[model samples]
Target chain A: MSRHTIALAQINPALGDLERNLAVHEKTAEEAIARGARLVVFPELSLTGYFLKDIVSSVALPLTSPFLGRLRDLSRRIDLIVGLVEETPERLFYNAAIYLSLGEIIHVHRKVYLPTYGIFDEQRYLAEGGRIRTFRSGIGRSAILICEDMWHPSAACVASLDGMDVLISPSSSPGRGGLEEGKTFANARAWETINRAYAQLFTCYVLYANRVGYEDGACFWGGSEVIAPSGDTVAKAEYVSEAILVADIDHAEVRRARMANPLLRDERIDVTLQELERIKREGAR
Target chain B: MIDLSLNCDLLRRVLIGFIVNEVRKAGFSRVVVGLSGGVDSSLSAFLGAEALGAENVWALLMPYRTSSPESQEHAELVVKQLGIQSDVIEITPMVDAYFERFPEADQVRRGNKMARERMTILFDHSAKLKALVLGTSNKTELLLGYGTLYGDMASAINPLGDLYKTQVRQLARHMGVPEAIVQKAPSADLWAGQTDEGELGFTYEQVDQILYLMVDRRYELSDLLEAGFDERFVRAAFAKVQASQYKRRLPLIAKVSSRTIDRDFRYPRDWGK
Candidate 1:
């Protein structure tokens, strides 16, 4: 059984201030390292704060940019998962999360789902990513999912079927519609439900690192957490405030949950692929 | 008698952060606020200072000759307390020049002229200082169209637009604004002794509650009346809200083209990005 200590850096980032945000990233990484965390996850667009319209291009960094080099320097002793606005040589932009280990970028996951609805306009400024998959990481086989990507159930299915042990969801979900009712953070409430469902269904460790702080009237409710394979929260952070939440995750729990309930073993991928193709043909009509 | 509880401490921190991000997002560090010493303007100034620092926020006191002395003094108290740079621009001379040509102008005409004239001063300073104008109209006033169009309503951005007048006072007091300013009767100070509640024939406390039910909660007119609100008050407030719907929207386009600006050629307000 493998054990990994993960840290979720749920901190406020100033918009368009790369230097200051980098300093914050460095500091948080150091703290995570001190706590013996094998991996630290950051929220969506952690390098260049969210809600960048035209400024997205201005803050876009290639993986080879000096900023990644700086992050690579910080990843020498501990693995890091941070979000950045990535620019290709073709000059297109993508909302991507880069995985760093052993002083190098190990994997890059471009967000497949670009949310364009209410309060989110990522599609207008960023190109859609082509795929989602599981990759071998310093923390074992894991998968990276950006803010809106996790909303699509199929994305998580692909990761789980590809044998991902841990699923990392870095997000900047805004707090909405709590001024008059039940939960103070309705968005966070939905997130908890969805994340727990993902953990229980996929029989894998789920780590969500969401940002804290208000940006242009849209408040990012942090509440970053780690959910066990049995769908119970292991650790949680404060809402609307910066917090470094750490939790110990065991791969043994995944083995135990999957052994007890063989949900994945029952998945008929050949049938799913055939039906998906048929749906693609008939969906337009 | 409406329960309008607000977490001012949490609201303040988030709003301050909102102001800073909104102002910076627009590529401007400085903001120009027309401080009338009222709770709305005071709260805006306080949040602006907290967001962009006291040095970046500029407060302008544009008062007509008929404007009360208390208004100017209270506005000055905010400027001093926030330590923001300020200038007092007297609009009497500019407004009187036009009014002298038509001495038969009524209070409404003169008041509208003063409001527009004050906006002119704020916009001119915005150009000179390279700052965006911070709006001060509260949700209660905005719903009833109590403010002069293209006057106090014109701004680059408004933080208090979502907050009701009663909530503004709550935040002002929470932010430790001068008690003299927060406790005063709500007034636009457009004319001599022209209080907002007095002119509207209803207190903000009453209207805010009704509007909260009617608008925020989306309760129908019959629902409000059934909820035991006074019929006359409900009808009057609801009628004003219905009548003033035009003020809340952008100027109507005639739709001469297949793609019209603000209609078919629609995009978010921050589409400049």
Candidate 2:
């Protein structure tokens, strides 16, 4: 379908409380379904709260866990994207987002970048994912980039090259660098710019789901939004408040944008790959 | 000079949310603040009242015999303005009774004792009221180690810990803190005729800018000098921050085990909340 309604579940998940967070997810998904949403998106680490330093092991869940069964059942009614700490059978953990539809796991995108600088210690606890790939969802071809993955342009470039119609970014971004006039944080402004640039450049829909509420003095600013292929914000939630932001997106817009700009169509993947290989060989030397 | 201006409206919302979420997540509905009538404490009380309803916030006005009467009156002004529950618990007896045994104690020792006495009262009331002790120390005082460790520095949660003194005053003014309290010279009220600027040997404005450059901007000593900051003042301010480093942290434990308390036993304060 070209036209569909999407909901961004801008919720505040309880820290390390998997049961409570699961209930929240179920309730928010039911509300979105009632509101005529075809798909619901949640922020990164929606099941387990961000900054889960040592408690990461306790909250990690395998794909076969009952929690995924419950979410998979919920997705039968409305396609759902939920974030969790995925545990492999070998005991390795990754920050992952799973797409569920028709009571089945459509795709699981492990977070590629684990930020380890100021206010982030993800690399110390969770193993990083190795792949950047897109999958077909109920809506269209899509890719998931958890938080820091969107910060790197190459990740989005690969997703766009893989022919993704929607770039889904789930973030637990902390609000910082307070500006005086705009009533927005520095991180929010940067995210908005990135979302718009990616939408316009890749000629695709950009769905950004960011959580709200304070955790240990770091306040995650919600401001979840949807950007059209025209680089226009279709809908936006309030900052620092929990909200389920819904917006209508049409794939026809992506087709029209690509036809008008032709930026993605006139791309040079061969030249790009050749230059990257040359740069890698030089670095190895 | 680096611009220290903050979007007061956004900051007020963010701080109010922080207070509400941090308090409720920790499983508490009420908070008690040691109101000293200073801008920092007053701002904390105001934010606390706004975050958790006025009825949920309790302000304690603890004054010593030597403390200025205006301190109590100013604190009362805040109580009356916000209409939060308050009590005037004079620390004179608690502080003076202890000092009587050591009459030769200097002002700093007596002041520290009074601060601890107030802390004791706040904690006792925290137990009685089942409320968290809201901290009021601003970043400037915290970085300078100007606060009494384990005394005024002790609290469950602090919303103003990141704001500098100038930023505190800016926010206080924006929040409509009574002009008298906002414009008044900042003092710990530990002794009569003493002000923080007088004790620190420089203005908060000067030190706040220097600290912003040093701490926030991560400017080097050379960068500070290149930015036209006074060498001696910057050196002195940096020394104060270095000397009082211990006050800003928990007591260091000798690491004997593989997983030390602070070194490897890493967990956020809001774990499992």
Candidate 3:
């Protein structure tokens, strides 16, 4: 499927209300399927809303959860990448994203970075994820990064090196700072820059799905977008509202961009690893 | 002065979304706001009327006997302009009835009593009408603790809580609030000839600048002084913010268990909604 339609489900999940959010997911996924989309992506914590605080334990679901089973069934019609709070048998909670295809969970990426600064308290309630890997999906070879994880370049670098053709970011970022040019938020503009830079540098399609609506007093600005490997935004959603943005992406473009730039091809991973090791050893002294 | 200007156009959409989404999430479609004819309350009323249709918004004009007649007039102006449902309930009788027993009650005491009385009426109406009380306190008053605890400070949600007084004026003008209310000197109007700046002993313009630096930007006292801010004024402004911290928080509950409310039992207010 070189050329396929993808949908960004930019929804506002009700805080701690899983049933209502599931209903929203079902409705949005049905619409995406009806629109001839092969895959639909939701924002971080799409199943359980962001700012879960002490209620994280109550909303945390094991991999065997029927909630996820419903999404897995929905994926039989259209592939899904949904964010949720994952609970291990050991009872540790993580901010996780699951890729469902063919009625099976294809890949699960536990968010490696837990932001604990300024309005974010994820570190206080959840354990840190320690893995970053790319996996095969219905679209192409893809990697998942939760909100704060994408802020770190090393995470995206690892995904690119691991041979990801598409970098999907699910974010529940709050709108802050000030408005830029009387329209977009400064923070939202910053995210756009980051997404475009990663798409151009990695020569991969960037699929950014951000949530909208108010949680407590913080408003999550949903400017979900799809950027091509050439650093061009193919489709963008409106801010502070729910939207299902759809865009047709061709893997041939990723091949063409990579052939033209060839930056990822010349990357020296051995040199980077050696330098990082040397720095760690020297700093230990 | 530091430019506290905001993009009122963008801010209007964000705040309107907040009012509409939050009220619906809390399972209500109607909201009641106590219209004081001041910029903050009037701006909130305008947003509420625009967010949830004017018919869903209820404006209550609760004026004390000593409140300026223009205050009532401006509040009525908002009601008529928005075509919202409104009722004028004079707080004079309720206030005077309580002060009758305590003849020696000072002006501050009387003012506090009136504020709490209005809160009582607002809450009572909230229950009767099944509407949420929209708060009108701005960031300047919240940071300076320039409001009565459990009085005008009480609300189910506050759309103006994050905006400073200067920003509130900018938004008020953008939202087409009457120029008279927007330009009027801000006053609690608990008594005659009383203004907020007069009681604070400084202009909101100066204090808002200081607060923007001290609180929002996290500027050190030394940095503020080096920025040419008067040392005395900066210190006093910081002190007021520190001293009034309690009014901005919920009542303290002494912890007796493993997980106490607010300390560890921290579920969001929108829990399960």
Candidate 4:
């Protein structure tokens, strides 16, 4: 059984101040490494804060952008997953997560779901991603899902089908709604429900890292956590406070839960693909 | 059975933290709240004091001539209980002097004048004390457009804007606010016996339940009707929310250019702060 210790760096990112945000990432990463974490994950857009409308284009960077070199260098000792606005050569932007390991960029996952409703306006500023895949990292086979992508079950399904041992979901969701007992925020409740369900259904360890602090009027609730494969919340950070949560994940449990549930084994992808294609062809007519 | 219950301990910490951070971020350390002796204003005072210490939170009691005497007593009770600095300013002279020219001024005009007059006093003292005026309007009053424009609607920040009236009452109980103020009939106290719900033609408890479903839960008109709301009441409530849309937004700018303020050119209010 391979055991990996992960850190959720739930730090507050100041809007449009790239220098300050980078400093925060460096400081938090150092702290996580001191705590014996092998893999560290940050919230969505950890480099640039959420609610960046016009500033999205101003702060967008490519994979080779020099600003990310600091993080790439830090990954030499410990692997890190950090979120930022990715700009293409043609000038399109994406809410993206870059996975760095051993002083190099290994994978980049652009957010597939751009939520436009309520407080979110990502659709106005970002291009949607088209791909979802799991890749080999220093910590083994891992999949990365940016903020809203986790809300869509297909993104998780695709990742699970790709044979992932662990799922990393980075988010910048705001605290909202009336308070309920055992849950201080409504959005937090939704997050708990979905993450637990995903862990149990996919039979994989789930790592969720949410940002904290206020941007404009929206308050990001930073209750980041790691969930076990049996739908149990193994560790959770404090709400509305910036703190790094470290938890040791047992990779053997993924195999244990998968054998017990056999949910992934029973999936019928060929039938699903054929039916989806047929529906698309016939419904368009 | 509406899920209006709150974890008051957590709410207190977050709200106080929010107030302190927001105020400090904006380069202010103190706050001013109008003490109306109502659940809304009293709750704002408590939050302000909890956020920025008692010395930093100042209470202003601006009473008109026809204002209820019990209102003044209750306001005093909050001030004494919180051990915060307070002053009583009589708004009757300013309002009477203005209304003398218009003998035909009705209750609406008089009420608007009183509200605006009280706000003027609050702002003047806010400048003197170097504090920002904390708003006291709740979500129900804001959605219904029950507040006067450019009057009590203006503030540096509003902590209670998201909580409904009933929820405010629930929170008031949790915050240890005086039960006398919480149980009393909610009144703007513009005239001798003006009550908020009496003029609105519906109880706050009833309206808050409907709003919880319609606004928060995103229930449709039919859904509200199915949930036992009267047809006429639902229609009126929905109409008010739609009609008061302008109150919830920035003033409309007539755009001659490609990018105008509040149109194509928009930025967060706390952009630099």
Candidate 5:
């Protein structure tokens, strides 16, 4: 079956304004679905601002929170993915993302990798996520990973193990020098290597959505895109701003790319696992 | 001690030459400079070539998709005139993807990102060539807080930093920048057709004049206002310089019962040298 329209919402969200942020998300989602898209996505931490800091604990909400309930209600029309900060019983915060569809809160993914250096201090405020899971969507089995999660090989590899169709990444990355060029190189590597590597291997589509605007003096460069299974950026946004982007997915391309690459059957899992184990050991050190 | 030995004339070149020497001694044979096709980077590319040699200086042309053709053309003309190795690559695919996801990003954030993207290219190629990144900002930009921190603002070495806007123009002319680029309005060329003067709400003529009287001649605000500057521009210029003063100085020290880095531990860029 051909996967239908997926909408990208580059919403201009105001920080700490829960009502306004939700309104922006709803407005953009409405715009996307009005155009006949089955899926609409927002940036990571779209609920609470990226630089919420200690304010995160106060604003952290559960999947059943009324704000989410509103989004869940809208899922009756089309699938919606909204980013929010979640708090746990032990008092650890998570940069989390939720997937909603058919009036149901489908899946929740905590950010696996915590970025601690530079402008980010996620480790100080967030509990590390240890496992990767794929949440099912209208497009079929899909995985969700947060910003830093996509940076490391282990996280992307772990997400692929579940055999998902699309990897949904919601991120809040701040700006760095030569970021435009650097990110061009990084995303190509991220999409081509991971999407081509995993999607082609598993026959899945890959969706990456990121945030925009300044939070606590850090500029978030918005460059979200959807890569086909063949490792090509089918659709890309203009520059750092907010909007909803949509692209149709050809499910057959995923299968066809898989047939051609045949990467999964030829994978050196044992060697990869050994290298991962070494990495984990080194990280532990 | 803060090295006051460097006067305006030889300060930039001397500092750059010394840093280049140190970098070479530290085993770097080349340098990367992102030619934004702007005045600052133009001056930086010039000084970098002088210090590191044209062969060792690689100028990068990483223009976003929307970047004006003239800016790109000027960049091409610059490296060609300087006889340095240059590469032209578009950052549209790379940058637009980020915006594809987040559309409400303001000009400030985009400008910051553009600067950082240029820096990333410089650093990446610098690593490839075992070189260093040359910074292209001047004292006016650094002092007035008119830059993106860690974005266009970061560099391994800066030679034009101590020069004022007026000084750079003179030096650019003195250094023989093609009459075209030297005379072109100073713009970051971030958007389709943007100028630094338009964004700053003050012309370089006005700003340079204000800065000269204020910084070089150390004139007071009342004096400038009385001397015929728009009061608001004068106040904004003052506040801008004051607000971004932190961006110009070293990081603040906690002063744990002793002298601090800026106060006591201060030294030259080439202290050992």
Candidate 6:
């Protein structure tokens, strides 16, 4: 198992200032690198302010846009992930995660689930994405999911299907009443099934980062967490400050844990997969 | 002299990080700052990028004929270092032709004419681009009534009105803002050879420090002078922030009944809810 330090930037970006955000990323990435981090991550919609007034339409960029290009240039040697708005010509705005390594975008994940209740009008601005997949890089196996994707069991199930060793969920969650406890609860809720079922039954890691700030009216509580194989939060960033949470994974533990259970071999997918496919096709139509 | 050491490196960075997140929550993905090649607009652009990502921020360089190339160069440098997109639009024709009808105006009037014209172009692009206009005026400017009411002072949102002049400079550094912008003499660039300190007969460092200690820091005038600030500068700065208190506030409309427009019944930028 190779050593890698994952650094999370719990930053509060201003509304609609692309230049300043980029500079902050550059500076912070340097700091993370100095701290010996090989992987760096930012919260959901870190590029454009989350609310994104009308500017969302104009500032929205395609993959080839200068914005991602700059990030691509910066991602050399550092495995980096960022949450941003990706404009698709099909009249769809994807809540996307661009996974970068060695200065190239290895894989991009579009959010499978879009939240539309209370303070989230995602359906109005973003197009829903299907087909949850994971990327197998040379070093480790990982999967990407935005904030709302963690809310469902199917997301982790889909990622496990791809044999992901770890799942990274970047988020921008509002901070209101009982902020820290609420975020901790949300992280546990999203991770319990994956960490306990998958980590114990199949064995894997769960990584997540939520943004922090007093946005228009609602504040984003930044309480990022890293859940280990035993379903315990091994490490976590504080709730309301800009800080990084770095953690290491012992790959040997993964092989040891999975072999002890051999649960993947006992899976019965025929009935369940067919039924899920039927639901998926019907929902898409 | 103003004391800006209160906004220390860590405190300033945290405050900046927090506000950037605040603006992000306000339903704006991008900001289009009118870079007049002046201190106020430059600071606004820098802060906007910190609040949003550099990719989501845009800067519009609206220059008039009298606008100096030196200032334009500075504006370009600020945008380039921050990695923001910028466009230079010359507003000379629009201003000159419109003002040709009222040729008997003085330099101040002509300068104001250019200022208003520049704002018009800014808002037009803002509408087309769907960006929130980021205001750049500092607290000292807001207080002393140095800015045009709706012209220079207008913005969909402003992040700097809370900071006095000296604090703005200190923040500029923590932001890793280009030194050229932080060190340059303040200027509105409305006309050639015009400097903000020279025109106002007081430097920003003096006025801002004075305003901060007097207002934000809540120091007495005698204390400020005792602390080595010139008596005249302290008095003028305090009076300005006090006299222009009206400009800093939302417009007050007479209420015959229960609620007034912007005072009691404000929830969001849009009243749809």
- Per-residue lDDT tens digits of candidate 2, residues A16-94? 9999999999999999999999999999999999989999999999999987788988988999999999999999999
lDDT of 1 at A129: 96
Query: What's the lDDT for candidate 4?
Result: 0.89
lDDT tens digits, residue span B28-146, model 3: 99999999999999999999999999999999999987999999999999999999999999998989998899999999899999899999999999998889999999999999999
lDDT by residue (tens digit), candidate 3, A1-285:
599899999999999888999999999999999999999999999999999998899999998887687888888999999989999999999999999998999899999999999889889999999999999999999999999999999999999999999999999999986662364677898899999999999999999999999999888999999999999999999988899999999999999999999989999999999998998999963
Tell me the TM-score of chain B in each candidate. 0.97, 0.99, 0.99, 0.97, 0.84, 0.86
Docking class of 4: medium
In model 1, residue pairs whose N, Cα or C atoms come closer than 3 Å (at least 3 residues apart or on different chains), thus clashing, are: none
Q: What is the TM-score of each predicted model, taking all chains together?
A: 0.75, 0.98, 0.98, 0.95, 0.53, 0.51
Off by over 4 Å in 4: none
Which pairs clash in the backbone of model 2?
A: none
TM-score of predicted structure 4 = 0.95
Lowest summed-lDDT stretch of 10 residues in model 6 chain B? B264-273
Give the least accurate 10-residue stretch of model 1 chain A, judged by summed lDDT.
A177-186
lDDT tens digits, residues B1-273, model 5? Answer: 111122234334344544455566446777788887767778778877777779988888998877888888888888988899988877777777777887899987787787777777778887888878877888888877888887788888676675667667767776777778888888877886688878888766667667767875568988887788788888888999999977876687788856566465433233222
lDDT of 4 at B152: 92
How close to the true structure is residue A55 of candidate 4, measured as C-alpha lDDT? 80
Q: Give each candidate's interface RMSD in Å.
A: 5.4, 1.6, 1.9, 1.6, 19.3, 11.5
Judge candidate 6 at residue B174 and give its lDDT.
62
TM-score of chain A for the candidates in order shown:
0.97, 0.98, 0.98, 0.97, 0.88, 0.87
Model 6 residue B208 distance off true place after TM-score fit, in angstroms: 45
How accurate locally, in lDDT, is each candidate? 0.87, 0.93, 0.93, 0.89, 0.72, 0.71
DockQ for all candidate structures vs. native: 0.16, 0.73, 0.63, 0.54, 0.02, 0.05
| Residue pairs that clash (backbone atoms under 3 angstroms), model 4 | none
Worst 10 residues of 2 chain A by lDDT: A176-185
Error of 3 at A60 (Å): 1.6
lDDT of 4 at A185: 85
Model 5 DockQ vs. reference: 0.02
